[model samples]
Target: MKKTINAPKAPAAVGPYVHAVEANGLIFTSGQIGLIPETGELQNGIEAQTHQVFKNLQAVLEAAGSDLDHAVKTSVFIDDINDFAKVNEIYAEYFTGDTPARSCVEVAKLPKGALVEIEVIAVKKEA
Candidate 1:
């Protein structure tokens, strides 16, 4: 059985999609932009947005009974490839242990004009 996740601590979905879903021991998350949960506003700049993206991912992962440490893969999308270095620096701060496999690409745009968006695949923590 698959379980859907809707994280209250993360920003609400801007579209008709849930935050994540769990099936077969794996949790797959929807892409998360830097929309602030409390305010529903996009964070400013690449750096701030990158950090906020991680915060949103953390909330969704936690809601799915996992954390960054258990992540198996990640996909990052950025509005500009030039911001890769800044985004990588912030990304490093979050996945410091047993980092997951990742792919990043520059997209022409994202929902709500976000600077960055991230989604994850992780194993549920052992209970």
Candidate 2:
């Protein structure tokens, strides 16, 4: 059976979708922007936004009984390709060891005019 996840510590979804869905042994997360959970305000700059994205991802993953360490894949969307290096720096801070397979692309825009957005697929932690 599949289960939907809505992390209380993560920012509320801007639209109708939930934060993630868990099926079998995996959790598939929706793309997370830089919105602060408490205020729903997008963070400033590529650096700050990137960090907030990871934080949001972490919250959602944890809600699904997973963490970044269990991530099998990730997809990143950014407003500017030139900010790849800056985003990578913050991304590295989150997945320091045994990083997951990732694909990043430059997009023209994001929800709430965010500089970055990230999504993940991860394995749920064993009980």
Candidate 3:
């Protein structure tokens, strides 16, 4: 069975999709941008946006009963490839242990022209 995940502490979805979905002990997160949950504001700059993206991803993971440590893979999208190093620095602050495999690429654009976006796949911890 599959269950949709939504976090009240995270920004609402811009489209129809939920924050994440869980099925077969795995959580698949939708791409998260830098939107703030409280005001629905997009944070400014690559550094701030990257931090916010991870915060959004963390909320979705928590909603799905998973976390950064449980992540098996992730995909990061950035408006500029030049911001990769900065994003990496922020990413490391979150995925500090047993880091998940990841792919990051420069995209033509992002929703709201966000500087960075991230989506993750994580396994539920064994009971």
Quote each prediction's TM-score.
0.98, 0.98, 0.96
Worst 10-residue lDDT window, candidate 3: 58-67
| Cα lDDT, model 3, residue 14 | 95
Candidate 2, residue 75: Cα displacement in angstroms equals: 0.1
* After superposition, candidate 2 runs with Cα above 4 Å error: none
Which is the better candidate, 2 or 3, if ranked by TM-score?
Answer: 2
lDDT of each: 0.95, 0.95, 0.90
- What digit string (tens of lDDT, one per residue) describes model 2 on residues 22-103? 9999999999999999999998888988888989999999999999999999999999999999999889889977999999
lDDT of 3 by residue, 1-127 (tens): 9998889878999998999999999999999999999999999899988888888888888888888889999999998999888999989898886898999999999998888999999999776
RMSD of 3: 0.9
Backbone clashes, each candidate: 0, 0, 0
TM-score of 2: 0.98
- In candidate 2, the residue pairs with backbone N, CA or C atoms under 3 Å apart (3 or more residues apart, or in different chains) clash, namely none
